[model samples]
Target: MKPDIRGRQPANRRQKGAAAEEAAAQHLIQNGYRILDRNWRCRTGELDIVAEKDSVLVIVEVRSRSGSSNFGTPSESVDRRKMQQVRSTAEHYLHVKKQYGRPIRFDVIAVMLNAELTTASIEHIPNAF
Candidate 1:
């Protein structure tokens, strides 16, 4: 397991993150959201999922935790600083994409994965911010 730049997380962490994001996206799709983007990145940060539902643009932040819930729930991990970063990134996306004057909503999709990473349970919170 190769460490990332700061040597804090192993490469498998990324794989798990990707898997969690995929699960979150599928959950959204099943709920009638049209996915516009996944892993949208810019200088500020990354937006995990961008979707549209009922003419409202939804910015989804996907969070996941595996194994025991010793630390906390996944959605609880998104603190104030992270919310600022997501808002900044979303602004950048809106300006770049020229999507102006559209209703927007922020959502959080929390996924809990089993130890073996075989299944995921998801909780979708709309207007999370």
Candidate 2:
């Protein structure tokens, strides 16, 4: 018997994540954020969202999990390692965009969905790191 060594996320989960990102983007736009990019990637890593508001460059991390518990809140999912990766990745992005001397901040948007796939809760933490 062979083993499932791919370690890939299920299609449904990927879809849910994509939906969450889109929702997050909309929320940001409504809140006066100008989205610069979505799913920006490089050899270092992938950034879920990049935006600007009030002349400040913002790096947003979106996380979504379907459940009824707060145990897996999105903010809790971003650990120190992930923050470090984000920092390096953001540097790469800034260099690529030639955005030197711009104030930058990291933000997090957490989405919790109901069993029916409806939005249950959303929390946006700005200047998270």
TM-score (all chains, Cα) for each model: 0.90, 0.87
Candidate 2 structure quality by residue, lDDT tens digits, 42-113: 989999999999999999999888875557677799999999999999999999999999999999999887
As a whole number from 0 to 100, the lDDT of residue 10 in candidate 2 is 38
Best by TM-score: 1
State, as a TM-score between 0 and 1, how close model 2 is to the true structure.
0.87
Best by lDDT: 1
lDDT of 1 by residue, 1-129 (tens): 556577655437787798889899989999999999999999999999999999999999999898877999999999999999999999999999999999999999999987556446899999999
Q: Candidate 2: where is the Cα deviation over 4 Å?
A: 1-11
